[model samples]
Target: MPPPPARVPDLTALSLLVAIARTGNVGTAAHEVGLSVQAATARLRTVEQQVGAPVVERERRGRRAGRLTSRGVLLVEWAGPVLDAAADLDAVVAALRPARPGEQPIVLAAGPTAAEGLLPAWLVELRDGPGGQIVLLDTDDPAAAVRAGDATLGIVETVEPLEGLHATTVDTDTLVLVVAPDHPWAGGSGVDAAELVATPLVTRRPGAGTRASVEAALTAAAPDVRAPAPLREVAADTAVRAAVRAGEGPAVLPRRAVTGDLAAGNLAEVPVHGADLGREFRAVWKEGSSPQGTARDLLRIATGGRIR
Candidate 1:
């Protein structure tokens, strides 16, 4: 590499010298830069040592006064563009900094069910409102993302209350037990919670909101029964639906996710007695922090202006 650059006085010291030249008084320049006169004097001595010449004229008979020598005047003029370029660099760095919530585009983290079924319409409406732009993240744990400040807002489907966050139910969804037309339960009256929990079914991966809701409902309804392992664990709702349509196994999924398949006779919804499969779709944010700017506008639009 090249030789290391030479050390020089920092910007603050140089600016202080320039200020002293402008005001013609050391104490006045010190006050302008929020420094004591004694501290400024020490700093000036350090600057002189670095420059290898006396930059300020010293009075021999009284308190120190700021009177620039010929060298100081020349140094001040040269420092003008250096200080200006430093200021411009500061502005550019600030512009490139990571955006805080509500500062740039609204960052929305959503669970698979909501991302697949709901947010598209709400985002379309937000396009016409004061909300400027949106960056959407499809995640399994949207509430956690919002709580950690990674997302400006979160949409999640759960019956449990979120700790350390504020949540408002914007909509609801139902988990339907679905199977292919050739399955034994396809045309039956329905199965009970015990039987549904005992069967190995196609399911979303462990952290998914859809899987959590179904497991919670099953555990609540049939506390004594042990649930069976999943026939296959898929990553997304569409993949789970595809597995069920291919006769992999029965699966419990968001009704909205399989509406088209159910209507087309490709998948059949089998009822589950003695258990509630309903869940609330909620908008969540950090505790004590209210949505603002684009997030607020999108929330208002999502809730039909009822949440503002």
Candidate 2:
């Protein structure tokens, strides 16, 4: 005979753990899940008590998110799929006879920038076809979404290598430094990798693909030096561009992401002297579950038969 199974924490607390994993800050994750700061803190403490371990590690140099502890990461990985499955069951039970009149659901999970900057036009094109239901969820962590069975397809900014999921390169791109026309960096040919890292700059949040590319490049360019940090992290490309235009700080963004501003003369692209920072956009999904029907057709259309 086996002993009784270990008791798990409440679902709400488990959800808070996953939220903390996503945002990396307890307060922010709490607010996202509609919990007050004190309540969130108490819930987290309760979780810690039950698990007999700390869930997160926080650091503040002014204000920014910190990293999750090993236990917290593990719990998030376990909880995401469970929560998603629960939600699915709820929806199915609510409708009892769920059927769309003329639409199939396409759940697309994407990194923040691509979700906002890239997919709008492509989604418009998709809408013209068979008129399926399109659901877009914004998440910086695409890999988690795929693993949790949340998104039918995912678009990520980097192609470094993600395990568990089958990823195909949809596009190749380079990171470009963008600055206001009047800024000092705008007049130069490009800033060297060392100088760029040394300088203060505005950038996307930590989990963003743009940030990932810059960090990777800086590391490769100067293996001995500490990687650069963002002077400020904004959630949207529009905000980052606005702040750069206002002379807040220089930023490195995808060439495709800021093409319009560069063409309009609202921003100038400064090259990174010693770093290529080339990245690839990938469409990812779980193994053995290739996108089928409309999803597959749209994938082909988006990539134009190019997969790699």
Candidate 3:
């Protein structure tokens, strides 16, 4: 009889080595794995010892900055298949237990405007047509959902790349200042950034995509003006609309989000000069992971084209 199989070593350390190799810095790799720099370094050392070879030449930055030794590359190449299989297994297991055969659930993270305005038409088509299972998660935490694999796709208003995720822009847009129709600034065709900054402004909490664009536009256009204390710092788009409608302060919102209000005469768009104040709406998915079949088809339908 063949001897019993030897116990396999922990692949966690091996995986970290791969991450470090790809990222080129411990800080970046550590963030991707949710590890502290010290812990990542220690793991790297441990893996090197276990392999009995110098797998990575660590730079002062403590990433795999130098070329991987032949042994290290071999270990990494061998481990790649193991990791791929494990990921497939996890995806399969998730698909099996709770979900029924016809219900192929895929979570999508997106901002409220996209969720409400953009996604529904495609979502209905997906459900009624070829695409069967679906769940929509409208959120500001697009990157987090993508990282957790809780979301198969994320539509976010950001140009910055999310670590470990592949991204493409579905749309490019600009922020427009919005105020209640009765407000003094209402009905103005458009104003320069400096003029727009002169009014009291309402803003969302920091890290909101619209907020970030608005702030950047304000800072560049009116550097001499002190940023007015925001009248409100809400999380959701609806709250921001309510505040502006109640005459709290002028608010900046995505053009898409405020289009209906603008047309309905409930709100007015104030122009900000000197700055473009644009944002990129993006679709993000896991690196090297393709959304095949229905998911792919639905994405194509939803986006109108592959991300540019």
- lDDT, each prediction: 0.83, 0.75, 0.71
How far does residue 129 in candidate 3 sit from its true spot (Å)? 3.0
State which candidate has the highest lDDT.
1
lDDT (Cα, tens digit) per residue for candidate 1, span 1-308: 23654647778888889999999999899999888989988888888888888888978885556788888888899889989767645533332345576557677888766766777667656654564666777678898999888898999887577999888878887899999999999899999999998999899888788888999999999999999789999888889988989899999998888999999999999989999998888899899998888888888888889673
lDDT of 2 by residue, 120-201 (tens): 5565555555444556656888878988998888888765678888888776777888999998888787888888878778
- Identify the runs in model 1 with alpha carbons over 4 angstroms from their true place: 1-103
Winner by lDDT between candidate 2 and candidate 1 = 1
Ordered from best to worst TM-score, the candidate numbers read: 1, 2, 3
| Index of the highest-TM-score prediction | 1
Candidate 2 stretches with Cα past 4 Å from truth are 1-104, 227-229, 305-308
Task: For model 3, state the Cα shift of residue 15 in Å.
Answer: 56
Q: How badly does each model clash, as a count of residue pairs?
A: 0, 0, 2
TM, every model: 0.63, 0.62, 0.57
**In terms of TM-score, how similar is model 1 to the real structure?**
0.63
